[model samples]
Target: MHDEPLPPGQDGQESPGADQARSGTSLTDDLVALLEDGKTYLEAEAAYQKSRAGFVADKGKWGIVHGLAAFALVHIALIGLVVGVVIALSRFLTIWGATAAVTGVLLLGGYLFARSAIRHFKEAGASFGDDSP
Candidate 1:
């Protein structure tokens, strides 16, 4: 049924040497493709991290505003409590006496709290091998 001879390299089946040469070329192409893929993955990761940091920074501004508002509210509440206590004590003692008593008690309590906080700070620093007095 065959009427003409086929070309040397155009036969139906590839030669063994030709297959080896093609495989060598394919290996190099695969290496280059792998490197390109890795570069793209790294660029994507960097972009994602940058986006996450921007999101946190944007939210951080509101976080600071809310935190300051809460802090101010707490101080206002404490002042109101102090005023209420002074008014209640005025019924038992003179106005000036009640004010002096409350002031002394508050000062003593603040001093004790300050001492306790200092002790705790020292203990925490000691755990990190700090020897500073």
Candidate 2:
């Protein structure tokens, strides 16, 4: 066979048609095996993707739950601190007086913050409008 001239599409290696003609293996068999391998690969990929998505979704749910829990904890702590402050102040003043004092302090803080904000805005505006070199 090596000494003889190679037949059409029969260069040293056997062709698909030659294999089918000489044995039980055929083009259909090869195609079926390829298709089965592709199906298996696709199924594995799909399963992995679904598993990843489920894992991410569970993490997202846990994150939201934990975030909300933390926010509620902080809020409760703030309220507790305010109550504690009022109770401590009540030793020297009436309940209403203590509450008023706290309110006054909060108002003063708010006013100072507002005044500082206004000053910053005015300074920024002046810089923007200044034409001097």
Q: Give the candidate number with the greatest TM-score.
A: 1
lDDT by residue (tens digit), candidate 2, 30-91: 89999999999999999999999999999999999999999999999988887888889999
Q: After superposition, how far is residue 20 of candidate 1 from its true place, in Å?
A: 8.6
* Regions of candidate 2 where Cα sits further than 4 Å from its true position: 1-39, 106-133
lDDT against the true structure, each candidate: 0.89, 0.89
Please provide, for model 1 over 15-95, each residue's C-alpha lDDT reduced to its tens digit, 9 standing for 90 to 100.
767866855667678799999999999999999999999999989999999999999999999999988889999999988
Error of 1 at 41 (Å): 0.8
Candidate 2 residue 14 C-alpha distance from true site, Å: 12
Clashing pairs in 2: none
